[model samples]
Target: MNTVQLERMKNDKGFIAALDQSGGSTPKALANYGIAQDAYKDEAEMFQLVHEMRTRIMKSTAFTKEKILAAILFENTMDLKVDGQYSADYLWETKGIVPILKVDKGLADLENGVQLMKPIPNLETLLARAQERHIFGTKMRSVIKEVNEAGIKAIVKQQFEIAKVIIAAGFVPIIEPEVDIHTVNKQAAEDILKKELIEQLKSLTPDQKVMFKLTIPEVDSFYEVLADHPNVVRVVALSGGYSREEANSKLSRNRKLIASFSRALTEGLNANQSDAEFDQMIGQSIQSIYEASIQP
Candidate 1:
């Protein structure tokens, strides 16, 4: 990374805080007195320790551009406080790192810059850019979904639209629908997944594919209905308000239901595999589908 980007990563407050907590010794102390006694022993051992430590630290501390971007997107908080007073001037002075007030203006500027630069072209462009930078992995996509779920649909839709424009440009109109699962009942959720959405999805294009964002509990019934329609390319199941562990546990319990849908869709897609292998692939596919559904 360039010096400017490196500076931005190093200057992140959360990252700096994490580093401070990771090492009991402050940067000042480390520069002045060398390694702490508790962290090592003897002069020779300390020398060796410092060498090993420096190598490991450099390896761990060198943050990538994508990491910085992800942190800004996911971990940034907008709560401005200037001398216990809240005001636009105070927020401006603090650079939008406040707790209570909004950062709409600052964010608008950033979004405008991103738009001008055309960072995202389409789904393919986005994926290609990520892959070219070696950060387009399944895990990173999962992180994108998590960030999208945090109610940042405008940003997410812009990215999704860009991706669609790049990959299947002019072939079909891809609709990016943002579904809210907060306090929504099963019937309401099912209604959203029904023929209404299917017709809307089909209306996008003759060959357009629909990607649905659904909570874990809504997957079985949701897909069961979708399974009847052979046009659906994917059913991306999302875990609303669930941690990664909890989502995985819930998904595991519903593996059979997912496998059934996967099996049914596989025949339509002409992708052949054994039932057992199909189950595993469906699990992995569902994870990726969910990851891809939401933008980072």
Candidate 2:
């Protein structure tokens, strides 16, 4: 890795705040907050709302470098302006927060609830755009909702393929193969995921590196293998569908993992909230997740 990439890898770990809501997630979130689907009117307005929320949260005194290492942004918000400067620039210059882009198009067909990210035919273009905008890294996700062995292997292979592309493009890739919290064979699936992930890491040449973002496993130390691997700069946890309290309790069990939570991090925040209420809600969420990440 070059100096910039190496430094970004260092800055891109720990209690990351995920705001990369694609069409698949955005509508559901807007609905949950009682914002009508038509309220945004179009994609531009939707992107504006996301940027507005991020600006509000990042401007808080409580939301500082010590609490959040980076924020993963959806494609539309990557180049948006926070002040006179671009969003990434403002975050870095003002708050020491690295900006990462969400590169996955969306999910494809499902099998036993396991799904692959839809292919991006113009991934190279997107990577160039992210780099042009000074994005520090990128994240992509696939699912392991069940213990289908072939499905598990396919997800691992696909993520590694994309990960290689991201690394070659001079960006740290956050490879997320998330297992559902409600899956029946959760422990077994975690074992499979850990094994496959470790095998993939072993295949990399000495200089190759990437980060792993995974569901907090049932076993407290299930992901220690990856955490200890030289190629893995950090390991972060997703909240799945768990509430904030539940996510925090489970995430605290794993000494190696920190958070990159979405819904759990945004819980109790709503579009209707006043500025003070918005800051207070997001501040509390950041504190809770930060405490879990730094647990002894």
Candidate 3:
């Protein structure tokens, strides 16, 4: 662990930028960026296109440590280069942004009201490579779609279990058990998640410091306790399916929970826009999210 990066994570007042769209979400992500499916011939070409998009975003004058504290990367992206530097190195050295890797293989079929992450048999290899590349941490996600306690419990359990391995490999883990925003019983599910998360916190040792990326709760300040938990490094909110404006408005109400938006962060960006237009749009997003993140 780099002490400087760890300290920055604890004290930073900026939000994270999620650029880690994996194979499952890449097509939709590309389409949103105004690149159609037929534009790319195969997975390799598709990823190359997405990487270019990500590089453009990363290279933007607005996307620096001044607003973005960190960024998450997909496995393929970690191996790619940006401006002749490895992605993680460029993020840290040029932009002053900490680099995090997304490690899950993606979610399994819905089970017991949730979708758990599929097994990552290659996690050790990924973690080792990330560490070698000067990456700071890792992120993995699972989804909760209902009010089933057993299912929610399982989600939390699986996340924490994987988190331990990541920590032992000498990296902080952002454990994301995303509660689907459109679920009818959203508030009830969040209530149970809070309880389950609190219970899970008890299993960690003093040296273990994990982070959380959660959905903005229906009620304001609902997750303040978790944000302030001693066992946690920090708490962040995912955009889920909200537009940038809606997500920013909701995020400002949740003190101590910063934004880690993906789609919302890049909502107005398009491959067709001129460089000036692209920079202006992303700059506006960075400013809004930065302000909301520092809300007290």
lDDT of 3 by residue, 24-84 (tens): 8999999999999999999999999999999999999899898999999998999999999
The candidate, 2 or 3, that scores higher on lDDT is 3
For all candidates, the clash counts are 11, 0, 0
User: Model 3, residue 264: displacement in angstroms?
Assistant: 0.2
TM for candidate 2 is 0.94
Query: Candidates' lDDT values, in order?
Result: 0.30, 0.83, 0.94
RMSD (CA, Å), each prediction: 19.7, 1.9, 0.7
TM-score for all models, in order of appearance: 0.31, 0.94, 0.99
Per-residue accuracy of model 1 over 141-227 as CA lDDT, tens digit each: 101122222233343444344434432532111122323344335444345335344443343444443333344554534444553
169 in model 3: Cα distance from truth in Å?
A: 0.2
RMSD of 3: 0.7
Top TM-score prediction, candidate number: 3
Lowest lDDT block of 10, candidate 3: 2-11
Answer with 1 or 2, whichever has the higher TM-score. Answer: 2
Top-lDDT candidate index: 3
